[model samples]
Target chain A: AQSVTQLDSHVSVSEGTPVLLRCNYSSSYSPSLFWYVQHPNKGLQLLLKYTSAATLVKGINGFEAEFKKSETSFHLTKPSAHMSDAAEYFCVVSDLTGGANNLFFGTGTRLTVIP
Target chain B: GAGVSQSPSNKVTEKGKDVELRCDPISGHTALYWYRQRLGQGLEFLIYFQGNSAPDKSGLPSDRFSAERTGESVSTLTIQRTQQEDSAVYLCASRPGGGDNQPQHFGDGTRLSIL
Candidate 1:
């Protein structure tokens, strides 16, 4: 079984400041990880994914995440937070060998960017 | 459509009523998935379909929740005898073909309010 956990329920940051959202996972096999962002009343959009190619993955809107195997972590980070970056972010995991092709999502972290 | 499309952007129904949510995957994409997001909660996988293979319904919460995908294009999620607890935002996603590491594109989703 594979599962993801978002450590923070909410994270508030001022515009122009750095942002971080913590996530951890447990998987029996090597896992495929992803970070998705959802704006209010909008569809979930893929921010980035880690499929074993790179440990440091960059995504759109200046977002990035580093996959640390030893820590079982894939925390999302932004060098500078923007007001428009306020949204709900989910960390997802999928098994590497399962034919199910389904993803397991975390509870999510709501980012609040202050102007 | 350039992206996944979902119908009935918003639906309000009373308890014991049945609801059907529809999803149209992107043209040429062969994988479809259904997920439910409750208020302040993470997304829960409902089902997945790939090509002509039988859907994986392992994540469905109950027998009342069911889904069907015609080939790899259109999919419908049906809830029989919906309850207040069934209120949620139903999300549909699709990817080009099927693989372990493919990133899924999502629709805006249908907000179902069961009263």
Candidate 2:
């Protein structure tokens, strides 16, 4: 079984400050991880993906995430918070052991960028 | 290029009514998926279709929920005798193939509100 746990249900950061959203995963096989952002009333946009490739993955906007196998973690981060970054962030894991390739998503972290 | 498209951006209906949601995936994509996102919750995988192969329906919550895909093009998800619990944002996604590395592209989703 594969699952992802987002450490924070909500996170608030002041503008110009750094931001971090934590996530942990449990999977039987080597997993493919992804971070997706969903703005209000909008579709989910893929921020970045780690497919057994680079451990440090950079994404759109100024967001990025690092895949840590030993820690069983993949935390999203940004150098500075922006108002437009306020949205729901989801950490997802792809399970291919069954050959179905279905995604398991976290409960999501709601980011609030404060001015 | 267009991303995945979903129909009926918003749907409000009385309980017990049947509703159909549509999805148009990106051209040439061979994999389509259906997911549900309840208020304050993460996405729940509903179903998956891949290139004429039997769909992976294990994620479907109930028998009332069903989906069909036409070749690699459009797909429809139908809910029979919908209940209040069925009220949520139904999201449709598609990827180029079943590879774990391929990130799923999502639509804005159909916000279903059961009255």
Candidate 3:
């Protein structure tokens, strides 16, 4: 069984402040984690992924995430938030257990940026 | 590489009607996936096709949802007797073979609204 949890449904941050979006997962095997960002009327864009590679993975737009095995967490973070970062973010875990093409998504966290 | 493409970007259907969504994946991608995202919900897995084998329909909401893939190219998802609750954004994604970093290339999605 595989599941992903997005601890926060919404996060509000002022522009230029640090951004944090938490996610936790439960998987019996080594998990494949992913972060995806979706803007209104846009398709999902892959932010980052962790597949037993380096614990910390960097993605586009200066966003990054750390895969902590012990904590079962893969939280996404950015040194600073930009107005363009206001969107819905999803954390996903593959159901493959070790295979491919099956993803279990988090409920999603909506990020709001204030000027 | 050209991204995945889905047609009929918007669909409005009356209850009890049927609708079909089309998807064309990238040239060399062998894994295709279907997912549903409601207004306030995360993505819900629908089905997956790997190569020319039988599709994994485990995540399908119900038998009313069915999908087919011809060769490794295009796929179609069919919804019979659509219900108001079935309205959502339908997404199609494709991955390169079974690689771990095979990021899922997504289509813009079809917005289906049931009236």
For model 3, name the residue pairs that clash: none
Judging by TM-score against the true structure, name the best candidate.
Answer: 2
In terms of docking quality, model 2 is: medium
Model 2 chain B is weakest, by summed lDDT over 10 consecutive residues, at: B37-46
lDDT of 2 by residue, A1-115 (tens): 7889999999999999999999999988898999999998887999999999889999999999999999999999999999999999999998677467567889999999889
Q: For model 1, how does the per-residue alpha-carbon lDDT over B71-113 read when each residue is reduced to its tens digit? A: 8689999999999999999999998867768888999999999
Interface RMSD (Å), each candidate?
Answer: 1.4, 1.3, 2.3
- The docking quality of candidate 3, as DockQ, is 0.57
Q: lDDT tens string, model 2, B1-114?
A: 788999999999999999999999999999999999988788888999999899999889999999999889999999999999999999999999998778999999999999
C-alpha lDDT values of all predictions: 0.91, 0.93, 0.90
What is the lDDT for B70 in model 3?
91
DockQ by candidate, in order: 0.75, 0.75, 0.57
Question: Which 10-residue window in model 1 chain B sums to the lowest lDDT?
Answer: B95-104
Question: Which docking band does candidate 1 fall into?
Answer: medium
